[model samples]
Target: MDESDGEALAAREWRLIREERWPGPMNMALDEIAAETAAAGGPRTLRVYRWEPSTLSLGYRQDPDTVDWGYCAAEGITVTRRQTGGGGIYHDSHGDISYTIAAPADELPGDLVESYRRLCTPILDAFDRLDVPAAFAETGRPALHDPACYLRELHPAHDVVVPGDDGPRKVSGNAQHRRTDAVVQHGSLTYAVRPERHLAAFADPSVDAATFRERVTGIEDHADVTRTAAVSTVEEALAEWADAAEGSWTEDELARARERANEKYGSDAWTRRRPGDR
Candidate 1:
C-alpha cells in the first residue's frame, strides 16, 4: 500500500464486532447508534449480526400494507422498519447473515455509488473467499416492484449477485442511510434462501416461491460452506478490510440502543406509519 493508503487505513480505529443475536428492533437501533457514535468520534465499526425469532424489516418508505400482518404475527415473526430504503426483507435467523458498516461520512467517498463500492469491497471478497464467484450486477434491471427486496430490480452498483444457470441471481441486498455526520450501510447476505417464509411475508397473492427462486439465490446453493462458516468468513473479510481490532458493545451503548429501540424501531408508530407521515 502507498503512504496515503496507509494513512487512510489508520485514520480511524476500526472495531470488528462478531456475530451477536438480537431482536429485530434492537438490531436496527444499534446500527443507528453506531453511526451516531462514529460521528461523535467513536471507533468506526463493522458488525455481523443475526435476527432472533426471524424478523421482517420494512424499508423506510415501504408501505406497511405490503406486509401480511396476520401471517407474520401467527408465524411469530417480528416486524420492524429500517432506516434505509428498499423492499422488506425476511431475515431468517438460520438463513440470513446480516452486516453493518458505520463511519463518519466525511471519511468516505461523497458520491453514493462510490461509497457503496468502497464499503461493499469486503463483502465481495468474502464471497470469493467462500469459493462463490460474485460481483455487482453489470447493468441495472427493470424494477419488479415486488415488496420483498430480493425480488426487486438489481442496481448495477450495489446489488451483489452470483452466477446461476439462468443468469446472475441476487445473493445480497444492500442499502445505505446517510446522515449529516455519518453513513451506515447494512445488508442481508442470503446464506440459504427460505422461499416459503420469504413469500409468506408479503401481502401480494400472485407472487410465489417459483418467482422468488428465479430472482434470488443463496450462497449455500453455490458453495458447500455451512451458515456458521459463511458468517465467519464474512466477519474475517470485513475485519481485514477495515484492519479492525476485535471489540464488543459497551454497556452504555447497549442501554442507549435499547432506549432507541423502544421509542422508534420497536414502536407501531414508526413501523406502521405511511411514507412521509412523520
Candidate 2:
C-alpha cells in the first residue's frame, strides 16, 4: 500500500473509550495509563470522562494556597493535581465535559503548537457540531484571576473561545503532558457555566460571578444543545476525527490505574508537592 493508505488504515484503528464517571484521582491515573499503553504499541486512545462528586484539579505547579480547602471539603469537592500545567479547574459534574487523547509521541508533530492544533481539531469540530462557533483564542488576554483556569490569560494554541456581544469568552481549556515515548492531551469543555462554584473553588479570588460571566462561556450559553447532547457531540467528533472504534479498558489496565491512583494521584504528598520536587 502507498504511504497515504498506510496512514489512513492506522487512523481507522484508533480506540475510543466512551464516557465513564470516576473520582478525580482515578481519572488522572487513567490518563497516565493510556499514555503508557499507547507508547507500548497499544492503540491510540481517545477517552471521554466525567468526575463524580465534582473535583478541583490543580495545575502541576499551582500553589496550594490558591485553593480554598475549607470550601472544597464543605462542598464535597475532591481536589487533585494534574500532570499538565495550568491554573486550577473546578470540574463540576453537571457543568464540564472532559476528554483525553493519548498516542505515541512520534505520531504527533514535534512542534508544540502544531501538535496542539492537531489534537484540538476534533474539539473545535465538536463545538462546530454543537453550533457553538468556538475557535482557538487569537491572542493572549491578560488574566482576570491567576489561580482559576477559565479566568487565566488565554493562549492561542489550546484555549478555545466563543464570540460574545462584549467580546470573546473562553469555553474550553486544553493542556498536554509529553513523556519520552508518549503524549497525553486532556481538556475540559464547559457545557454549562457555574461561575459561583468556579470562583468559590479559589481562595479570595478577587473576581465575582459577573466578571466570570463576562470572560468565560459554555456550550449551552451559545447553543441550544443539552448537556447530554453536548457530550455525545464531542464523543462523535473525536471518534470520527480519529476514525476510531469503540473500546474498553482491560482488567490489568484498570488494576494498575487503581494502584497508581492510590500511590500518586490520591496522595497528599503528590498533590501538595512543589513543581520540581516530584
Candidate 3:
C-alpha cells in the first residue's frame, strides 16, 4: 500500500462500545477485543458499561485464587482478570461505572505515565463538574498489593483521589496497556461500597469495613448527585474531552472480545503477577 493508503488505514475512529449489563468475565473479554481492534490501526473508541449483581476484577497479573471465590460465587459476585495490571476492585452495580478507552499510540504524547494523565483529564473534569475537588497523585508511590483497590495509593499519573476520612483515598482505579499501535486503559469509578463483600473478597482481607467506606467516597458522598447523574456527567465530560467525537461499538468487536477472553483473560496463567511487578 502507498504511504497515504497506509496512513489512511492507520487513522483511528471515534466510537463507543456500550454493552449490556454483563458478568465480569464477559466485560473483561469485550475490553480485550476492543483494545486489539483499536490496535489494529483503526479509530479510537470508548466503552462504558456496568456489571450485573456486582463483581470484583483482579489485575491481569493478580492471583485470582487470592480472592474469596466461594464467597463471590455464593453471592453471585462475578470475578475476572483485566487486560491491564494493578489491584482488585469491587464493582457495585448501582454504585459505580466502568470505562475503557482504546486509541492509536501516536494519538497520545509522552510515556505511559503521561498518557495516564492525559486520559484522566476528563475524569478530573467530571469531578469538577460535580463540585468535587479531585486531584491526581503526582508522586509515583508504589501501590500496595491488597484486594481493596483504594488502600494502596500510587501516583502513576492520575489515580483520582480527594481528601476524605483517613486522609486522601483513591476513588477510582486505572490500568493501561500500550502495544505497537494502540493503548487501552480501563478503570473502576467507585460510587458505593458494600463493606462486607469488599472485606470478604480479599485474600489478604485487611481493611475494616467502616475504615474502607470512610476512606472511599463517591459522587453521592461528595454532592447531591446520584450515581445515575454521576454516570451521565462522566459521559458528557468524556465526550467533551475527546472534542465531541462520538462513541460507539459493533458486533465484530464483541466477537473479538470473546475470542480474546478464552485465550488470555480466562487463563489462570495470566492472572497472577510475579514479585516486583505492577
In order of listing, the candidates' clash counts read 0, 0, 11
Worst 10 residues of 1 by lDDT: 1-10
Report the C-alpha lDDT of model 3 over 101-138, residue by residue, as the tens digit. Answer: 77777767557777787777677788899898778754
Better of 1 and 3 by TM-score: 1
Residues 50-155, candidate 2, lDDT per residue (tens digit)? 9997999999998888989999999999999999999999999999999999998987889999989888988998998888889999977789988898988889
Candidate 1 lDDT over 1-278, as tens digits, reads: 24565468666799999999999999999999999889999999999999998999999999999999999999999999999998899999999999999999999889999888888989998999998889998765565556778877788878999866677789999999999999999999999989999888889746778877888889999899999999999999998887899999999999999999999999999999998898
What TM-score should be assigned to candidate 3?
0.84
Worst 10 residues of 3 by lDDT: 1-10
Which pairs of residues clash in candidate 1, taking residues 3 or more apart in a chain or in different chains?
A: none
| Model 2 segments more than 4 A misplaced | 1-12
Q: What TM-score goes with each of the models?
A: 0.96, 0.96, 0.84
